[model samples]
Target: MHTPTTTPSPVPPTNPAALLRAMFDAAVAAAQPARCLPPHLPAAPAKGRLIVIGAGKASAEMAQVAEAHYRRQGVAVEGLVITRYGHGAPCEHVEIVEASHPVPDNAGLVAAQRLRKRVTGLSADDVVVALISGGGSALLVAPDEGLTLDDKQAVHRALLASGAGIGEMNLVRRHLSALKGGRLAALCHPATVHTLLISDVPGDDPIDIASGPTVADPTTCADALATLARYRIALPDAVMARLRSGAAESVKPGDVRLAGHTCTTVAAPRASLEAAAEVARAAGITPWVLGDDLEGEARAMGTTLAGLARQTARHGHPFAAPCVLLSGGESTVTLPTDAAAAANLGRGGRNVEFLLSLGVALNSEPGVWALAADTDGIDGLEPIAGAVLHPDTLVRAWAAGLNPRTCLDRHDGHGFFQAIGDSVVTGPTLTNVNDFRAILITARP
Candidate 1:
């Protein structure tokens, strides 16, 4: 009698770096406009001129995809979109303007003026499609009636360094802007407005995305002033007066102009995190999705996750080993107070900072591997997406004469990863769904 044939088991990924990269890639791919936009596109207006206007890191790509979709259906489209510098995508009919991001600039101010003029005289038969995403607030910058671009820039810098959340910051931006906080939709009134959003905020609230340029605002000028006071951000007298006098109020909810406008979120941080979980499952690993709305200090979040990873690996309290824990959202970094100390801090983005902190906390824990990256492929202001950490990360750093704790204290995650050649650089992915983090814990053999 012949012996029964045996099938060999497939080999698991021995290199944690490769596995983590695959997970990050899956997350980014899931948020791409090509994959998410088509399904949510509203039918072309039955009998109106289609004018597209948008701003954000993903606005250019969103516009390009929309143009391609309408073109395939023989529908003509025209309009303009503003995106962060170096994030532009080619679109035949829609003009793509590049401007500074995380900071307001003259280029964006000019673009906002042009975009407002485009929608000003539209009739009831005309349709306006607003493609909004993260970074749109800074990229669509047009200061309020009494404020200058310089004044806005000063306030932006202060808000950024104050450890303020995106919601608080956007509230200030909405009131100080000429086109944001539903004013653009008001300008396009009588024209059917369809807004598509790629949310990067914690709650995916349309009102918070790009400061809700095309959606009604529930926040008021007083709220904006309160945010400034909370953050200790000072503004010019005229700018402050505008808020105090309620002259800079945003278009509030129940505004007649926003009655028929439609807003839809085509892609979001939760969807991207779920996509990464799928990749983990396919690899024969259990997936634990921590959350898509996590927010707080970058380093503290990293340390907290490390503790969970340890618990999962040792006690299996929340999850068993052979699992990957995933989370997505934006985390902030508070710069050092001393100028000398701040100057000494090395270059690194928030994602790398999170990863670096995690590595330190893990302290060479065996069989634990992780990755932290921004879905947009740029962490903070750095060129790299983020980085990966393995059990041997700290050992390798020590061998290289680098101290992980020292690097973390200096806020030099980029430097630490670069020294070890473990930085994950993907250039620009043309999308923004916020940060992605994954920790993989393997079962003991």
Candidate 2:
């Protein structure tokens, strides 16, 4: 592993929560576009214009970084990037458009149309720098012909509530989007398109990140239909007809249009976890990275990890105390099947749900504390990133008349944490490497 270039200020060992947050901050800092994107930027074309185009929670910052990097070398840059409403950064050359996320809106629809138009008529000498990352799938929305913006919005809402994984979600998205599934890259055909990605999906698959706008897609419309059927997600008849007729087919591999295109994953979940591990090691605490691509139902993940924490805390087996267990990847939450239960659902993201479930399973087990959050600074639809859980988490909940198990049942992890003053809120981190989770076990047995 490469050494972390900077060390965070040491948080006293007595304060595990502080240390956990410190580690999270380090992970975010390590993945910043300014630090990761510059090294992989493509060289300017000697005789042609340079155009920047992208969409994601991190794309704005990515464009800003790319602009600064090229401007330093005396290259003129111009283009557009779409991001979540609150995730935009200042960019002089690249136009920053803020749009809805997790769900498509009219603003996104118009921006996507502009993006598709922007890439047309490019020549061989032109260079297109595509900044892609998590959340791009929704931010860069161009509904397939015959599908309305409202129709696309409904599809997203169904997929979100359907308990589908990111890859599955993107599969559906790609077929429904005119610009996704490598169609955008096809439009930039003949130009040397270079894509920089900060992956927020499991396996770091370029095809799944932002639905691979600038990369060739191997999946077909039939595959997208299968995913929707598996998840029991239904779409409008127009969308169904488009997929059935193969009218929504994406750009495939070996297509000459993408012949000279390139892609690079500048940052990913594993690297961020390793950065946190470095901080933990410097603080005299052993850090164990369980995996960078864990996926499952949110609450179940919490229960399973709680068992590991208990074993380490009680028996010191597999791993000794005074160690932190770190993991990354996307965890899903399957909303309640019952309408009444869904109606009573509280606001929270998957990260807090995992932490709350973990806390309940621990039952205030001494010397075990944890934090789970999204590195992009938004957990689910909430502005809050995630939350923290300490040995006293349950104790505080009880004292405050908050029932952790009940909150878990109602999908109210955010409310539970916020009520107990443990919710971790970091607005607009400007980078995404997926979820960050850490379980710290002190040496006291």
Candidate 3:
């Protein structure tokens, strides 16, 4: 009589934790600013004054690359790049401004204003290189003329909880700001604009990053109004007036003002995800890349993936044992009721939530280990991007008095994983390629 093993049939490398870490690190290496920011970069036009303005998690490094490119090309450059706090990179010619993320703050407001100022007063003789990446929407916060920081923060917080996709979130953002939705490009009207982007949005739409600060947006004010309504996010009275009054739409394609401008994608999630798949293949594990543009709610997404992994374990239909599952994309979480200031509210981002949900579904199935993380090194607002869970996770959690199902119900995966010391913390990677997820499946016979 054979004893039934709790995991999939064909065992992979005994240490799946190491396998997950390797894949994640490979993904990050492919996306590091130093690697991804160079090619899309062009030689600064000869005899043109170089001006750089940017916003995003990777904007600082993007700025660094721009400065370096122009410097090597003998083009003198002066500019400012705003990124989330701790995402700053040092550049001699460019100012790197650190700001708040997911939520706008005073620091970001000031930085956005200063970035606008940097592009202002420019002439046709000037060349403005806009360096952009993910997370810029919050980093590039500059309320229109009369709006206060408080007002912008309130609106942003509401939209985040609204379950809106990046496109919808940015649509509203473009209407309410001075720097987003190509308004920044408008400010540098006479100057020749060149936007070098590191896309974090699915489908790689330049206009979606940081609400496309320098990219044209065909989305109109009416569309913005509809998005807010669809999300049921209430806006301040001033914002309402701006919308009712027909604010300028972001730069649209074919607009002559943008004909002279150029936008290039320097790096993307697909590139990073592919790189990771290669790492897994090199390790002798076959890799199935679901995609790099995945997006959806945290828990539901996990449930779907959990089902797939289990199928591979039970039937090996899509893939055999000794395989790894790979995917990349940004996932959102709707914070649960903060009532009671829930002390056990787990402390992680979508990755943690996904893992917790996976743990519940997997039910401590032995032999399979997995990891999830934000490639930027931070997961949600927490320092840990994600953690690894083994088949015995259920046993371990119960021993620690953590009910995996209870944690999942409360959206407190972060808190639960923290208690287990399973959270993977890699502070401030300075680049965001969205999120990286990998599951290692080994066969048990």
Which candidate number maximizes lDDT? 2
Per-residue CA lDDT of model 1 for 61-151, tens digit only, reads 9999999999999999999999988899999999999998788899988998899888888889888889999999899888888789998
| lDDT (tens digit, per residue) of candidate 3 on 261-367 | 88988788888878877777766777777888788887888888888788787777566777788888777776643566445465557888888888888887655
Which residues of candidate 1, in runs, are more than 4 Å off? 1-12, 443-445
For TM-score, the strongest prediction is: 2
Query: Which is superior by TM-score, 1 or 2?
Result: 2
Task: State residue 72's C-alpha deviation in candidate 2, in Å.
Answer: 1.1
Local lDDT at 124 for model 3 = 83
Q: Which residue pairs clash in candidate 2?
A: none
- Candidate 1 vs candidate 3: which has greater TM-score? 1
Q: Candidate 1 deviates by what RMSD?
A: 5.0
Q: Give the range of the ten consecutive residues with the poorest summed lDDT in model 1.
A: 1-10
Which stretches of candidate 2 lie above 4 Å from their native place? Answer: 1-12
Candidate 1 whole-model C-alpha lDDT, 0 to 1: 0.87
Per-prediction TM-score to the true structure, in the order listed = 0.95, 0.96, 0.93
TM-score of 1: 0.95
lDDT by residue (tens digit), candidate 2, 1-445: 2333444342337889999999999999999999999999999999988999999999999999999999999999999999999999998989999999989788998999998888999999999999999999989888888888888898888888888988999988998888999999999988989999999999999999999998888898899999988987778888889889988888889999999788999999988998899889888787888888999899999999999999998999777778889999998998876788889999889999899999999999998999999999999898999999989889888999988898999899889999989989999999999999999998545
With candidate 1 superimposed using the best TM-score fit, by how many Å does residue 50's alpha carbon deviate from the native? 0.4
